[model samples]
Target: MNRLAILSVSDKTGLIDLARVLVESYQFQLISSGGTAKALKEANLPVTKVSDYTGAPEILGGRVKTLHPKIHGGILSRPDLESDRADLTANDIQPVTLVVVNLYPFEQTIAKAGVSLEQAIEQIDVGGPTMIRAAAKNHQYVSVLSNPAQYNAYLEELKAHNGETRIEFRRSLALAAFSHTQAYDRAIADYLTKEILNEAQAKIDLMEVSSTGATSSQPSLSSSYTLLCHSPKPLRYGENPHQPATWYQLGAAPKGWSAAQQLQGKELSYNNLLDLEAARSIVAEFWNDAPCAVIVKHNNPCGVAIAPTIAEAYQKAFAADSTSAFGGIVALNRPIDEETAKALTSTFLECVVAPACVASVATILAAKPNLRVLVLPEMQQGTSETVKLIAGGMLVQKSDDLPATPETWQVVTQKQPSPEQMQELIFAWKICRHVKSNAIAITGDRVTLGIGAGQMNRVGSAKIALEQAGDRTKGAVLASDGFFPFDDSVRTAAAAGITAIVQPGGSMRDGDSIKAADELGLVMVLTHVRHFLH
Candidate 1:
């Protein structure tokens, strides 16, 4: 008797090729449903439709095609058990040897803009998950493939074992099948929860049409939380060599850091990736303005600069804090050139990331064998929300990515800033947002002169920044993540010869700082927005 194989899939990638090989090489009968059946027949391959094989017409617009007893019995039957064999024979059911199936694109559908709840509900697969779970539970006598990427591996296994899959291979595929269904169900649950919350909020808004004035700018919290991560790649260690670590990607398809191509050097450690992300975020701030470079150490940016050329940008950023730049992660907004590659290789850096790198420059970078080089084209794509695990729960909030609008700023001092000084202030303000509070950053001539981050108090942070800048503070600008509580910091900045100051002014004693700035003949601007990164 010929072996039986059921092929049902939403993604058609490598479908015809796999089906043809199964029919010609393995002598397996094909049973498919809906689009899969039509595709196989169109290619002039032999296939039996599920409706025809079960001797039942598809009802409810083809949704009831694969939920029949024959389909489930064939997938769950065990040839070794006498009772199962008798039941299969009594019902004239053929035992299914292989199940090639994938679910509908539910996540992709909901990712689109303006998708309705009904539309997303329609995309959720019912019979697909049912059949997948059944096959996975009976992996001893069945082999299930849930993704297109598994087709080649399945074929290789069959070829190696003389047209029969090994028990271990089938077990692995079964595990993947269950994981696939779990992720699908989680996506559906998350979508429904969000839509239901929005519907309830809309009703509340209608009830209080005139009583409540305005809604809060903050996004509402969700009651339910779900995360689907897979493909755990083990690292040598975490932040330290003693801590064990593993990297789990978010989805079946690789994205974000997983999508980045590492051109050379050692595997990335946990700390290396953290520092690289900090550098990436800071360099992304100046992506379209000019060639920019940022160096990060211990999850904080130590140097950031923008120049007319990529080589000059790296040089300026490195010169900003040479001592801290050693063994730091570097990010560049432009492609790596020969000049930049030479400058990058001159230092003992942990990693260097850019949008692109040519073959010649890559060869030059090869001189540093242990330095990691990554090319990620989408450097500006950031997460929509950030999550942190806490005691017995987690915290979730929207990312602080609000744009810096200098035109709406209030000049609260007697001295006004020039166009050039205003641009410098905006640059400093952008970098300050990424630093840990209490944060202070001093910049001059489009380069960071000194940075004071994660201090106990604002005055202490200001003193550290000014002392580090030294003579550079004479013509530089200062940016604070929060409003000054007193005029002492303002006086301290003026004493350091700070030409202008930018801060989020909402403190109770804002007048004292404004008066101090006016008396000291310094330009002070209030952004009306606070960016306190903890």
Candidate 2:
């Protein structure tokens, strides 16, 4: 008896070629359905229509074509068993040796322009997956071809090995086919449950979306969504040798940090990711047109500076808190050059992230194998939502979307700031927005002179900020992340020769801070909204 081969496909990429080989070279009887039969007939290939073979007309819009036993009995019959062969002979069913099939384009139909939900629902293949699975399950007796890419190799194997494909090759193709169908069904079910159904049901549907998409041409339902939480790996030890602890990447994807591509260095540790997050958040606050460098330590900004040259910004920021810069994470808005990398490697730093790294500079940094390097293709700027975990739930809030427009700002105090002072004040205000609550930023000549963050009271934060600035406070502009609870901070800043002040004015003692600024000959502007980074 001649070998039996079935061909059914929605995507007819290499169908004609496969059909020709099956009829002319292999002498296999080609059985096809609907469009497959029509296409094979046009090519003058010998083919049998599926409905004609089954002796039943296709019903229900061709959906009921291949669900009959005459087709599946041939595929499912055990060729090794005399009983199976007897049953197949009694039913006049020819045993199918090879099954070539691909499912309808459900994904493609759904992705099309102006495709209705009903139209997309119709594209879901039923009998196709059933046939594919039946053949795949009996891979020992059947050869399954789901992808057109596999056709040539399969034909070669059969031609070389007396028309029998290898068992291993058959098994691999079956596995891929099952996985493809599973992903497809999951996507369809998830889309229907979410988009077509109501909100309460939609939340439940959200959990069903798969992370991976099917790439294989065969229909297999093996790839499904699975939820697994991963534990973090601690480096060397914890905070101390006696401490037992590990860290994990937050299950939530890191916002803009995800765009960064690591160019060179060792795998990033928990501490490295934390510091990078802080630095990236701070640097992203500044416009991409501006050159900025942020040095982060223990999830806090030690120094941040904006300048015309990235090297100059890095130098100024490093000068701000040289003591805290040890093993710090550095982030830049621009690319890193050989000169900048050399300057950075001079100090012990954990990592550096930029848009691009020059090849020569990357080679230079390769000497330090422990240093982590990252390249961010795009910088995320502007206001985004912030989510914080509380005791049992999350607290979602709008980020500090500070108005960069000058019109929103009010010069409430008597002393008007000079042009240079105004520029530094605006820059300091932007940097301060990313710092922790009860924060104070002191800057001079576009460089952060000092930052006092996470303090208890406004006055204490101001005092710390002044102390950090030391002599640099002279001719520096001061910015408070939040409103001044008392006028003491304004007096302290004025006493330090702080040229101007920028802060949100919502406190009951705002009048006192304004009065103090007027008396001490200081330029104080109220932004009307507080920015508490914590």
**What are the Cα lDDT values of the candidates?**
0.91, 0.81
Off by over 4 Å in 1: 1-5, 11-30, 34-48, 58-64, 76-91, 94-98, 105-123, 137-143, 148-175, 188-222
> On residues 1-534, what C-alpha lDDT tens digit does candidate 1 reach at each position?
889999989999999999999999999999999999999999999999998899988898767879988899999999999999999999989999989989989987887889888888788888888889999999999999999999999999989989998889989999999988988888787777677777777876776686766553325555577677877889989988999998888765667788899999999988888888888888888888899999999888888999999999999999999999999999999999999999999989999999999778878999999999999999988777788899999988888889899989999999999999999999999999999999999999999999999999999999988888889999899999999999999999999889899999999999999999999999999999999988
Worst 10 residues of 1 by lDDT: 214-223
Cα displacement (Å) at residue 394, model 2: 2.6
What's the CA error at residue 225 for candidate 2, in Å? Answer: 17
In terms of lDDT, which candidate is strongest? Answer: 1
Per-residue alpha-carbon lDDT of candidate 2 for residues 205-322, written as tens digits (9 for 90 to 100): 5545645542322233333332211234566545555666565432223324554688777876656776777787788777455788999988878888887888888988898999
lDDT for position 328 in model 2 = 92
Note the residue pairs that clash in candidate 2: 177-220, 178-220, 178-221, 178-222, 181-220, 182-220, 182-221
Cα deviation at 71, candidate 1, in Å, is 1.0
User: How far out, in Å, is residue 63 in model 2?
Assistant: 10
